[model samples]
Target: MIYSEKVMDHFQNPRNVGKIEDADGVGEVGNAKCGDIMKIYLKVDDNGIITDVKFNTYGCASAIATSSMATELIKGKSVDDALQLSNKAVVEALDGLPPVKVHCSVLAEEAVRAAVADYYQRKGIEKEIPGCSGNCSCCHLHDEHCGGDEE
Candidate 1:
């Protein structure tokens, strides 16, 4: 299969490749079956500005490109604004991903949202999240506690 030059460049020399040991939030997504896994680390300031972003991913070329591009797109953005990022935007920024590889971009978007959501949860501000009704047990559960009522 053909790959874009940008994709090749990113896959060869991905940016923000390492983990943040004490990140403000960390998000991990994708399963082994999908052939891609992404972990995003973010550092947000008191004003909710994304002061830094980094990622570690294991996947194919398109997945690496998406992770690299997603980090670049979110760093320095407000948490709210960063949460607005979509897979389409990442794909567009990368000059378009192949149809079969689109899932990589989707994973990137989900990783960012998960990180931001974790940040909101840490601050006890889940209600600020768009579309969150603040009623789920997951919203109020304390750190290290599981209140989802699954059991």
Candidate 2:
């Protein structure tokens, strides 16, 4: 399994690695088959900009790298813009990931959407999470995050 240099760098030095005690929103996702679990935290300003982002991941190098890159992509972006983030973009930002490890990027994307959904829910906003594929097991397990009926 060849990894990109960016992927290795991120794996060795994962960013935003801890939980935020006062996070405005939080999201968790896992792939039981691969045994990867990811949690994302966000602090959004009242103006709808993401002031900060963090993540905790337990898996292989790809999982940690993808989680780190996802945070970097969303921080300082508008909530709406952050919601537009996609796994393909994450993969591209990382230079790329091996075909088999691509699922880690999907987890990163889902984690971001889940955290934003939590933020919206906390603000009493009734809105659908953008970019939700509704195919991840996390969505079926945590319906509130995806706003979809569990499969």
lDDT of 1 by residue, 4-118 (tens): 8888888888888888898988877765444677888999999999999999987889988999999999999998898899888998888888888887887788788878888
Q: Using alpha carbons, what is the TM-score of model 2?
A: 0.86
Off by over 4 Å in 1: 128-151
TM-score of 1: 0.83
Candidate 2, residue 4: how far the Cα is off, in Å: 0.6
lDDT of candidates 1 onward, in order: 0.78, 0.85
Most accurate candidate by lDDT: 2
User: Judged by TM-score, which candidate is best?
Assistant: 2
RMSD of each: 7.1, 4.9
Model 1 poorest ten-residue lDDT run:
134-143
